[model samples]
Target: MSTLSERDSLFLEIAVGEKLISAQQAKLCKEFSGAVSENLVKNGLLSTEQVASLQQKVEDKLSSGNKVAVAQVEIYKEDTLDEKVVALAKERQLISEEDEKNCRKQLKKLYDLGYNPQLSSILYSAKCISQEDLMALYKEVEPNAKVSIVAKSMPFSELSLPTVPTIGTLKRKTRHEEVQQQESIPSETIHMLDKMEEVVSQISAPEIDIASEIAPLKQEEEVQEEVQEEVEEQPTNESVAPTPVATPMPTATTVTIPNFDKVLEYLENIDYKVTKLQQDQKTALTEALSHEEMEERFDSEDIPDELQRIIKRLRHVSEEEVQVAIRDGVGLENCYIPKMSSSTPIVVKKVNFTNCVIDQVDFAGVQFKNHVDLGNSRFLTKAIFKECHFVKDATFKSCEFLNGADFAKAKFDGKTTYNSSAFRRYVSFNRCGFGKKTVFTRCYFAKGVKFGEVEFTGPASFNDIFIDHRFYMEKCQFKDSSTFSGARFADIADFGRSKFEKETKFIGATFMKWGSFKNCKFSGSANFNTMNVVGDLAFDNSTFESVVNLRAISASRNISLQNIKVGNEAAFKFLDAHIGRLFVSLSSLKGHIDSHIQEDYHVARKEYGLLKNNFREINEYDKEDWAYLMEKRMERMEMKVKGPLSALKRFLNWLALDIACGYGTKPANIFVTSLAMLVFFAVFYFSSGTTEFVPSGELALDHSVKIEQSMSFIDAVQVSFRTFTNASIEGWVPYTDSWLNYVMMFESFFGFFVMTVLVVTFSRKVIR
Candidate 1:
């Protein structure tokens, strides 16, 4: 370690230069140690936030045990650095038997000129070596090399490489050593040399393509050392061979960390960052911006003059290069050359940069005319995709959005898929438009996937979509409906105030941690069959225009149906469902009664009770009392209506009461039925010729009394009215010996019972 005095001198000078400390403060701090001096100077000029940030960085460094970390790389268990170096050099055609002498000399020159001896190591640190590529490289070297991990290796900068001798330069010194070395060399070394030559003579050679993760513009001031200490240098002696290493399995690889603060600053200040253009292009851009009175949407008409110029020059961009294009705070834009020839396909290659740390990448207003595949990619920093238009199919499978991702107002005209992905932080898809089918299958959202006001024009699939933490989809509009089959939620799965226009499906879905669907509107058939919810399923103030099939749901918790408006086609078909409790309103219960969907009696019993009580609380006693009677009626209806005897008895009771007055619940039915019966009986009496009636105070006891006076319709009605009222009147007397006498007797008894029932029912209705 550097001496305290030397450190103090260095730190004090730095503090003074950065204006973080006054000259006098620096002078006073110069007497202390480096760390103490830094603290004192920081306290003198810096705010608490700045001091805390610096302290955090210091703490991280101290905990890491590396004063100046070069690679920020860790050692792997299976593969050693020597093996990787050999593989990379051989694949790059830098080290081979035919050109071994030249390769060594070139390496020596590069090392002497202060260049990193391992450019491949640099790429590895940048997370460029994929698992597939690494395994392939390992297999090729495993046969010839007895690979082993070196124990307690030195730092990368201090490593000593094994020097390879020149075969082309056959000098006196080399020839003498070669003759003696060949005799003393181990058989394994000879075997390895022979295999190396054989590998070169093979039919096909493996290719080594090295590219860093998110090799963006070098617009910052960070010069990182590329040597990786995880890999040890190989043995230099040709006589030694069969060196075995006891290595375990490989685990997570290393990644090169760029200067994060500089990258962040660059991204935040990247206003109007555009591609480099000539004078003519600049003029076209200026003219295009000038023609726009307001910020227009995605059409060529907004920038017609610019677009026409671009039409002449623009070709299809089939390949996107990943390299640093920034220097000295100015973006040296990468040439987006179009590969639009007949020989080249118009589709661009994958925009994949796994484990790459890229800052806010503004892909706004970019139009993908062809397919774009970005699978297994990661954006470690923030990203922006506002107003981006995908004219064709686009895929982003197994990608991660680590930082915030903004995809607001983006348009997808074709199929867009994001399968088995993860979003660690907040993400937005607000106000986005989907012209074709879109999918987000089995994706995990650690934070809320805020997708408010989005319009899905085509079918959207969120099958097995998991909200690992929180979920939000307020006011979203599924214009063509969607499917969320097998979706699992953990915490706060809120989809409040959304709209579904067509068929919505949630087949086999599990809303476990917390479920909410408040104030939503479903204008079509919604299938929630087989959905399992361990939490409350809130649908307060929801509206269903058509059917909502919750047939086989297993909501073990309560479900709220407060103020919900279900259409004529829908009812809670909780046949096999297991709901703990329910919250509903009177109007909603009335709807369920009208719909009369099949449900378990035990499950429905509690809900009916609740409905009745709620109605009473709201001063709707008529409905409450009716529901009470209806509840009992429903129970009776469920009482095994299978056999003929039970059916006959139920039919008799229904005829006696429910058909006419709904079991004393409907007074209108009683009045209408009684009035009709009275008229029919009166007409029957008027048309009959079996009996004659005499207008007297007494009745004739014999059938010999003929019709002295013809009985008219008015006289028959008056007699029928008197019999219905049960009034004693100076009226006609019936012939007791005639068949009409018995009929009149039965009618009088029935009329008395009917009048009594009507009076009691009317009194009950009025009192209640």
Candidate 2:
């Protein structure tokens, strides 16, 4: 048996202890699992011929095996349990869209275990699902080997067969004949009334069974005798309604008809008792009357509630009346509508105040229950809405404010649209609450817009808006999609410490100063494509439960991202971000931050230094050394200018340090490379046999053919090594000042370089 090397023995023992090899295989190697793997082909346990035969036997044994009831390749399909579970949960109202997303993420981890982990069981433990629902889901993911036999509870009598009525002596109407009679009515003539009549008649006089009724009465007579005995014991007066006497059957001569007016009157009265007639009457009155029809209906004196009366009276106030009321310094109740919820929502057809100039207006605490519109209106001096309430939709589209607008701490209960509106001075919506969707599409802010500490319970938008000064939106909460695409912030814009429940978008945005989004939480994806920033941008300490896309972004200054947490790091991709100075982790930012090291190394070097410190703190000495070495290499490359001497220095640095020893990251590479170089030179010298050795005058023979040709290949190789090593060749030597002698000298110096590189790399690896 061949003796095992010390390293081999150690590796084998570790492998065996870790169960990487089987105990049965150890028996063949004389009682050790790993020795068999290393020495099966090493130790002469069997003859070479027997080994070959045994290998053939093993292949035949494995290939001849079969598994019963195995599904075919074409039939065995992979089922995505996550998609199915998520869809089912949504359909059953068991989870919200956000919760469903979270569950699907959990399901992916379970799928990697080969068997579907009991997610339903986990939900059951959390009281999120019922046992019955869990059991139903369990059937889908149960192993194919576990068979369930479900026995139906119903008997044969419960499943009815198609009825085949027996032939009778009397003539009876067929269903097809009845249907034909009903279809014979003229298409233009409305049969809906006749249908109602038929329905009423059928309900009043249903089909009767004489035998069943007579038998029930006979049983009642017997029950009457028993009741009489009980009546003697205890008597009481309780009246029961008598059953209606059955109508006598008509003879062959009799016929029946009906009056249309009476029937119509009865049906109308029944309909009026319900709300159908009242609603229809109001709708018809609304459509038939002129502009005066609703005026008298909204009279303030007739309304019982004061709030509703005030709201109703506003319908009669014309544009001139409103202007007059404002000019006279009217209170909120006299000018705008009062909020009332007694009836349906009041909708004013039009609130046109276009081209009207408002000198000053303050609606600090007024409430409006109706829709408000001030389209194209101009606010010349001041407009204060510090705590105004809008319980319905409001629009200020195309309106302009010359002085300014203040909406701080305001509340919007419905959609608030500000499309194409212009504010010449500072506007504030700070600490405001938006209970529904709000839009600022194409709006212009000359000074700036502040929205810090605001909470948006619905979707919010700032599409195509222009801001001329600093914009602040720090510590905000967005419960739905929040978009700012195509918007421009002239100065610094901060959205720090914000929480987004749905997708947050900032696509095609431009920033003149810093656009910070630090310490944000995005439950959905954050998309920031095609953004251009002149100054610094930061997204430090942000968490993304979905992918955070930052593609096609440009920044003139530093673009920083550190401590980013993603739900699935492998699924993220950052493309086309031209970083001036990138701050990111190497392990997580592989291939994404690979370039721009030469362009922005001045500022990026500081982050690289920090990365080196981090790696050292983590006890990853190898990575720490690599980080430090790379930082130095970049610094060195930056030190030299782009010229002839610089180019020459770089070329020499690469050849001596990088290729030979991997910039001192690898020590063993030097020895392997040096051996390869020696072998290469030796082969070349032996094969060509061009150089002839000058002989000493010791009665030597002729040198017609090369002397190397007379020597064996090994002897030629020996001669080549001796020449490279500058060893004594005694009587044979290269001609003085010949190319061969020069080549020999170069090889000697090259060997010294190789040795030096080996020593430096080895020392670094050991010390680090």
Candidate 3:
């Protein structure tokens, strides 16, 4: 063995303390775990007390299930635990060249750790958990393992030979034989009577089992009493007799028919009551009626409640048929016969079109156990079941109506589907409740439809529905926002006249024609932000409770928002497409008055100024281009102003001057001559009368002498010129002279008029 130095012994002790060893690496480094003890015993490096401390630390960590590499332990030898690991690794040469190259890609430079701090921490923490786990992950990349498991055996096995159970065969009558037996029957057929009795028995409450146990004696007594009463009353009605009581038939007993015209007549004559007939009279009557008569009776509005009750009892009877008279103009009562219930779970069912015409249908009061299908059925022209009760699933799939359908106030407790139904005229479902997922997908409306107060308490979908005319859903409440995505309107659709009492959506809906949303009120959020309209979009007086999204829309004509109000942050945002024109009235934009409105006002004013300048510049160009640009400028200017009044006045003034210039007179000469004539006329009109006086000789001589004395050569020449022009010898006028005063008044008036004309002309040309 080589003699060890203090440094080597310390390094081995530290390596053991820090635990930087893998199991394989530990094989090479584990000797260092006790290096401090050995070194102290040999008096080589560390003191015995120091060696003891180091051993305790390493052992404690080992007992705690911690794995330490040799390098990590070595780190404790020279420096504190906070010292860098890479520096220690470099000093010790713990990694081989190939390992160093591989680790370099991940470790790289120290500063590079900041770029992916999360990834670095994950890699470092993973290594600290277990060296084996890190090595396995690295080797996964190197081996390119597919890492899939194959099935070891089959999950199940097939059975061997089986035992078959034997069933007893029974003899049954053939259809021909049964027909022959029915022909031999003479009196009221027992099959018809038995069926009628069964139907009547079936009419009782569903809890008959429990009720029968308590009232079995009472029920028997009541039946006997009813029988006694019927027998006594049977002879009173001369034309009809009661049905004879028959023995109880087996559960599967079949019924055969007999002509029921006489029995029907007897029942009708007695107002649908057969005194001699037992409780089974209902099934018996239906069995006697023919198919044609049954259809006619079912469609008739004149059906009495008692007759309907009998018809319903025999509706399912296989044997004896009944005749139901169906004549036009006859009112049918209780025509919406109650439907049958089965034990099976029905997801979707439809049984429409059984009757061509029905009136006074009372489905509003009945509960359906399963989906009710009513497609392509014609109801009476005024058929109404506005408040029907639906207990289970219901459907009106592809139903067509010739008259108005009133389904207002109906309650649907399950999913309802009305896909492809056509309402030829008005249909009102004002307050119906669709409790489950209701789908009106692809329904067509030829006229106005109202669902004003309908409550949809489910995920209602009107996806791709067609409205040929108007669809109004004012004040409608939806528990969840109903989707009208992909719906198409063929004509003017008015949603503004409707109310969405809750959140409603029309995302991606296509409005192919004109649409009006005037005064439609929303109490909750509405989303029509991404709607696609291929026609005019008008929203007058519409109020939105939440944000209105008109973010991205393509409207062919104008989008008029004359008086609409939105409650929250509006998104007329991100409109980068060509908007034909946006007409937002002043009052409607009140909320934006301080911001967009003010900004737009200033911008409009600036635009008008720029347009005016543009027009002026264009007029200086050649006629053709000037005309075109001027037209464009004028249009832009018109947009910026109330009207074309300012432009018209300027044009008229310029035209008048141009016309005057076209004539022969020089403009300056005409102006000067006109001014001179106006002055002469004013002088003539304002003059007071001229006065003549005789002068004394002395005064005249004095005047001549004074004139001679004042006359210089230039004065004499002026006097001679004045005389040649027939100048009058007029005396100088004083301030108080009448003619001079009149002249001054005329001059003042003329000056005032000239000043007024100048002011008016300047104002017309410059101010406006």
Candidate 4:
């Protein structure tokens, strides 16, 4: 009894020899437990159905006792056999050791270059061994001597057959009998019989010469003709009974043995044809089942009589007939069209309507299992595909829809593409669902298009698409990344209240009309980089939970970003963006707006300037002041410091314009600075005792009547105020000998400048 492992190994070896599995696959199968076919299926090396078929084949081969022949052929393909052949040939003195070494070196080179050449073939091609010597050596080295020769000599089917007698055997027997009956045999005849015996001995050899062996048969025929003539000349007295004759062997011309290479080629052709036929049958069966299942589903429903008639027509008619009906403007309404193929009607797989002109048709509730192509087709009237399901790739490349088209509530579970298609009238894909990557590249929509409430579970692309009418994609949900790169809108393009859960890009898109993304929500990065808008664009009340890139965006009209919310981790990139007018307020941003532009001063400066101008145009005075202050600050930061003088100028500019008065934008800063300066001077004058009070005489004008006492804080304040106002007080003056007089002049000059700025700012506010 064979062990399970031994049986599995035998089965796998046969499978490998039949090209069902590779030799490496067979080796891998042996490392695992269970039946070889089961292990192969488990490892995904072969399908379950394929393994079952292979098991059947292996069983048949084993029962037929051809396992050894297959196993020996597999061994001959291995490197171990190559080494054995070289060693046995050397042992027999057929090739020297140096030749063997050279052959090994050449074989290694061939192996390095990804070639798996046989050692016998290599030696024969290099003239190191003759064909006869190589074949004899292989026979001796191989475990099954007959397999070593017959495997190469004939096709696999013939090699597996049981041993049988050859035509040469009967010929040899007949020639020997003729020689034995004769008193004397010719020298040529004797030699020919000896050669015939040798040929009969090596009957399995493919190299046997039939032409040389058949020459003796021709001589025997000539001899028989001469004997008949001699017998006729003798003249028999009594009537002779008719003698029965033996059936002559077929001549070489009549029974020609096919060449070994041609036989192998013919066998390979047969195998290929059989495999193709099996695959075709399997496909046809699957398609038939699908059609029957769909028909059963419809039969169970309470549909109308017209719909039932249409369904029956669609099922019974051939694909060409349906195409002809479509071309003839037949209304195929409410029909469940089975999958169609033109060349092989039995295998109804893909449905192709390429370059056809179709009329009005409704394919409601149909399911397409394989590829559905309508490339270069023209739809003359309204086409409806409500609630249809595409189970594989669907293509509508270069199709023209002269009338409107509707695909409401359809489900696409495969890659869907629409390249260079045109819709002249209104089209809708509302409530459709996509399960894989969907593309609409270079499509043109003349009338309005709607994709409301669509669900996309895969990446969607609308690259280079052009819509001359309104485009609506409201309330849609994109679960994966999507792009609209290079798309152009000639009219309003609305994506209001949509949600994008992954990265969304609109790179290099152009909107000639208004574009809206109002109330949208982005859970991932939203890129509008290098976008251009000729009309107003709005993102009112939208939410961005991730990075938003608006780099190099150019809008000729207003861009409204009112009441938008951003996440804390979200960032905005407005690098080199040019907006004619921006409508955003501080209260509009509900979360942290990452507009920290300190890293790039040049961009920061431009961005701040744009904000300032926009705010001023909107007449939001407080926001304008803030934007103006930020602009000046960014400009000062951008200023390059060269020398000490330039550095001092920069610092002074910062102190005066930014810190002191907020670039004349903040009126409160000037008043605060003036009061602060007044207090400082007043404290200095009082603490230093550098001020005196002068009293006037009553009757006459006195030049100076000074009270040489310590000036109080009130007198110090009065003197500082009077000096700052450039007015003289009647009773107080700076002491002549004190160095505070120069301080007073400096304070007055600074006070005058501060007062001038205050007046100018106040006057401007009042005028405005």
Question: Between 1 and 2, whose TM-score is larger?
Answer: 1
How many backbone clashes are present in model 2? 0
- The backbone clash count of each candidate, in order, is 6, 0, 42, 0
Q: What lDDT does model 3 reach?
A: 0.44
Candidate 1 colliding pairs: 81-231, 125-256, 148-245, 216-324, 217-325, 217-326
Error of 4 at 211 (Å): 82
lDDT for each residue of candidate 3 in 1-768, tens digit (9 for 90 to 100) = 354443343344444434532233323433444443563456444556656666664454333321110011111122222123333333455333444343334333212211111121222221222333323332333333222111111101001000000011012233223333544432345444434432232222211121111111122234345445544654442322112121222222222222333344445443445543435554545534443345455556644455455444432411111112211112123234322222222222333333333332334344444445555444434456566666777767766554667888888898898887777778888778889999898888777687866778888899888887777766566676677877888776765466666667777787887777777766666667567788888877887665454545666666777668766543232132234555554333334322233344333333333323433443422222222333333344334334589667545434333222211112433344335535554344323212211111223312222322222333333322322233455432212323444543554464454434444544433543
Per-model C-alpha lDDT, please? Answer: 0.55, 0.54, 0.44, 0.64
lDDT ranking from best candidate downward: 4, 1, 2, 3
- Which of the two, 1 or 4, has more lDDT? 4
The CA lDDT at 160 in model 1 is: 19
- After superposing candidate 3, which stretches have Cα over 4 Å from the reference? 1-364, 367-383, 398-404, 501-503, 522-525, 529-536, 574-579, 585-768
lDDT of 4 by residue, 1-768 (tens): 223554465566556645778877776766766676777777787887777776775565444422111001224345677668777888888887766665555555444322344555445434567645665666566635322211111111221221111111212334324433442434443333232232223234333322232222323334345435533643264222111121222121012222223322332332223344344433433333344444454555433355444445442434567655434434333233333322221212566656555545566777776777777766655777778888988888887777778999999999998889998889999999999999898999999899999999999999999998999999999999999999999999999999999999999999999999999999999999999999999999999888888778999888998888877767667667888888886654323334553256667666666677777777877777776777687788888999999899999998887778888987789999888888888888788662333422222223254345556788778778877878766645654555676999999999899999999988877776
User: RMSDs, each prediction?
Assistant: 25.7, 33.1, 33.3, 21.8
What ranking of all candidate models by TM-score puts the best one first?
Answer: 4, 1, 2, 3
TM per model? Answer: 0.44, 0.38, 0.32, 0.53
Q: lDDT tens digits, residues 1-768, model 2?
A: 345443333333333433544444433465443444435556643345544544453343233311001000011224454345435766778756654444344344324211133333223322355534533443444323122111111101101110101111012232123323543423221233222322223222222222221111113233334334433443233211111111111111011112223333343433223334334433322222322233233333523354334433333334455544434433222333212111112222323444444445556766656566667665654577777677877778887776678899888888888989999888999888888898999999988889989999989999999999888899999999999999999988999999988988889999998999899888887888888889999988877676566666777676666897655422232355555655655555442232332255543444445456656755667767666766666665566667989888888777667666677677777887777777776775556443544443332333443443333456555655665556665534444534566766787777777777788879867876
